[model samples]
Target: MKQYELNTIPDEGYRQALASLLYQLADDDFILAYRGSEWLGLAPHIEEDVAFSSINQDTMGHASMIYELLASLGEGTEDELAHGRPPEERRNAIILEEVNGPGDYLIEPRYDWAFAVVRHYFYTVAKKVRMDSLKQSSYGPLAEAAVKINTELYYHLLHWQTWFTQLMNAGGEAKQRMEDAVSRVCDDFLGVLTLGPDGESMSRYGLIEEEAILASRWTEALKKPFDSTGVQHPPVIRSLRGDGRKGEHTGDLTDALHTLSEVYRLEASGTW
Candidate 1:
C-alpha cells in the first residue's frame, strides 16, 4: 500500500470505506463543476456569471484535493485518474452530470436558472452534511481535507441559498420555474445522499456518520428557509433516479465525462 504524508492507519475496512467516500466526493464535485463550467459564458447575467465561476473553480479545486488523496492510496496518479477515465468509469450522481437544459453548450443554450439554483442548493446542503461528518473521520487525511473544504463551502452554501430563495420569491414566471425545478430536483436527489453498498460499513468504521443522520441533517438545514417561504415544500427525501454511488447512472454523466476529459484526453500521457 502507498503511504501518505499523514501516518495514521485506520483499519483495512475503514481505509476501504474512506476510499469509497473519497471517490463519491471527488466525482460529485468533478461532474457538477464541469456542468458549472459549461455555464461559464452563458449565464443570464454577468455578475452572476462571475460569482458562479468562482464556485465552479472552488469545486474543481476540491475535486483535485480528493483526487490527490485517492492517488496517495495508489488509485492512480491524479492526472491519469481524471483524464484517462471513460464515462462509465465515472461515479458522479446523474443529476449533476446532466446538461444545463435542452440544448448543448456549443449552440443555442437556453440554460434554466431555476434548475441550477435548486440542484446546486440541494447538493451544497448535502455536501455540508457530509463534510461535517468527515471532519471527524478516523483517517487523518480525510479529516484534514474536510476541514479545508468546509471553509470554501461556506460561500457556496450562502450563494446557492440566496439564489434559491430569491428565485422562488421572484414571482410569476420565476416562481413557476423554480417550482418545476424543485419537483425535478426532488425526483433525482437520491443520487446525492447515497453512499453505495458499503454505506453502512462506512458509518460503522467512522469514515462518516450514518447515512440517515446525514440525510436528516440536510433536510433540517433546508426546512427553515423552505418554511419561511410558505411554499409547499415536501419534507420527504426522494430519489427518483437510481443511486450513482452503486454504479447506476444516466447518459447525462457519459456526455459530461466526454467533454471534461476532452482536452486532457488529447494527450493524457503528455505532461501539460
Candidate 2:
C-alpha cells in the first residue's frame, strides 16, 4: 500500500474525498471530547473521573491532529475549523452531540452514568474498527495518524468495556440502568457507523472501508459482550434522528457548539 502525502494527491476528487474523511474524523472526536469534558468532575468515582478525563483529552488531541492535516491541505486554520464552523458545517454524528442527560451540565446535571458508559463503550468499539481500516488509508498522513491514535484507544476501550460488563452483570438497579441505556444508545448508534453521503467516494478512493463492512465488523465484535448481557443485537441499526454526515443534525449540536466555542469565539484572532 503506497502512502500519499498531501502534495502527492493531485486528483481533485481524491483530495475532496480525503478532506471529507478528515472532517468526519475531526468532528467526531471534537464533539465527543466536548461532551466528555462536561463530565469532568461529574463521574461516578474520583479514579474513574481522572481516567475518563484522560480519554477525553486524548480524543481531543486526535481531533487536533486531523484538523492540522486539513490545514495542510488548504482548509482554514485549525482553530477556525474547530471553533468557527457553524452547526450545519459540522460532520460529526448526531449521537456524539446529544446531551449527557436531561439538565444542563453546569446546572442540575442529572447525568446518566449508565448512558455514558454504554455510549462510550459502543463508540470506542466502533472507533477501533474504523481506525483499523484507516490504517490502510490511501492518504499517508491519515494512515499514520490512525496508527498513533490507535495506541491510546486500547485503554479507552478497556475502560469503557469494563464499565459496560460490570454494569450489565450487577443485576439490580445497575443492570436495569445499563439495559435501558443500551436501548437508548442503540437508537442513535447507527449514526456513528455511517460515513455520510460521500462515503462511497471515500471507499472508492481507499480512504476507509464501506459503511456496511464497518458496521458488520463492529456488530461481530460486540456479539460476545452483548450475549453476555443476554440481549440480542438489534436486527437493524438505523439513524433515527438524521444523518450527521450530510450536515443534518438536531438542536443538541447547536447547543454543544455554543458551549465548546465560547472561549475560542471570544479570542479568535488573539493568541491563546
Candidate 3:
C-alpha cells in the first residue's frame, strides 16, 4: 500500500476512513485530558497532584496535535473540531468520557483515587498498544504523530502502573478500594479496546491493526501487572454504555463537552 500524506490521499473512501480514525484518536485524548484536568488540586496529595497535572497537560497537547492534523485534512480548524462538536459527534470510547465518579468536580467532589489509578493504567496500556500499531500506519502524518505520542505514553503508563500496584498492595481499605475499582473499570473497559464499526476498513487501509489484535496486545501487556496486584483479568470485556465509535454516548460525555467547550463557545468567532 502506498503511504498517504494529508494532501496526497487519492481515494475518497480512504480519506473518510482516515478522518474517522483521526477523530477517534483526537477525541479519546481530548475527553480523557479534560477529565484529568478536573482532578487538579483534588488529588489525594501534593506531589501526585503536580505529577498528574503534568500528565493531563501532555495528554491534552497530544489531543491538540491530532486535531491540528485533522484540520490539515479539511475536517475543520483545530479549535472547531475540538470544541464545536456535540457529544453525539464525538468518537471517543464511552468509558473515557464517563465522569470520575458521583458528585460534581467543582463541589463536594468525591473522586475515587483508586478508580482513577485503575482507569488510567488500563487506558494507557490500551493507548500504548494502539500507538505501537499506528507507528506503522499507511498514513504518513499519523505514523509520525504516533511516534511522537508514544514517547509520552511511557511516563503515563509508568506513573499509573506505580499507583495501581502500590494501592493494590497497601492492604486493608486501599486494597479493597483498588480491587473494587478494578471490577468497576472492567465492566466498561472493553469499550476502550474497541475500534468501532469502521475498524475493519481502518485495518484494511493499513490505518491500524485489527481491534482483536490490539485487544490481545493490551491484555498481554497488562497480565504481569494484574497478576502482581492479585487482580483477576476479566474473561470478556463489555461495552455496557454503548460504543462511542458509532456515536452512541452516555450523559457523562454531554456534561464533559459542556465544560470543555465553554470557553470556545463563548467566543466562537474570536481568536483563542
lDDT of candidates 1 onward, in order: 0.82, 0.89, 0.87
User: Candidate 3, TM-score vs. the true structure?
Assistant: 0.95
Error of 2 at 198 (Å): 0.8
Global Cα lDDT for candidate 3: 0.87
Q: Considering every candidate listed, which one attains the maximal lDDT?
A: 2
- As for candidate 3, its clashing pairs are none
TM-scores, all models, native as reference:
0.92, 0.96, 0.95
Backbone clash count, each prediction separately: 1, 0, 0
lDDT tens digits, residue span 1-272, model 3:
67888778879988888889989998999999988888999999999999999999999999999999899988899989999998888999887887887576546557888888888888899999999999999999999999999999999999998998888888999999888888788888887888888888899999999999999999899888878877776435777877889899988888888887788988998643
- What is the alpha-carbon lDDT of model 2 when measured against the actual structure? 0.89
CA-only RMSD, every prediction:
2.9, 1.6, 1.6
> Residues 1-272, candidate 2, lDDT per residue (tens digit)?
56688779959999998889899999999999988988999999899889999999999999999999999999999999999999999999888998898666556657889988888988999999999999999898999999999999999999998898888988999999988888888888888998887899999988899999999999998888888888777434668998899899988899888877888988899532
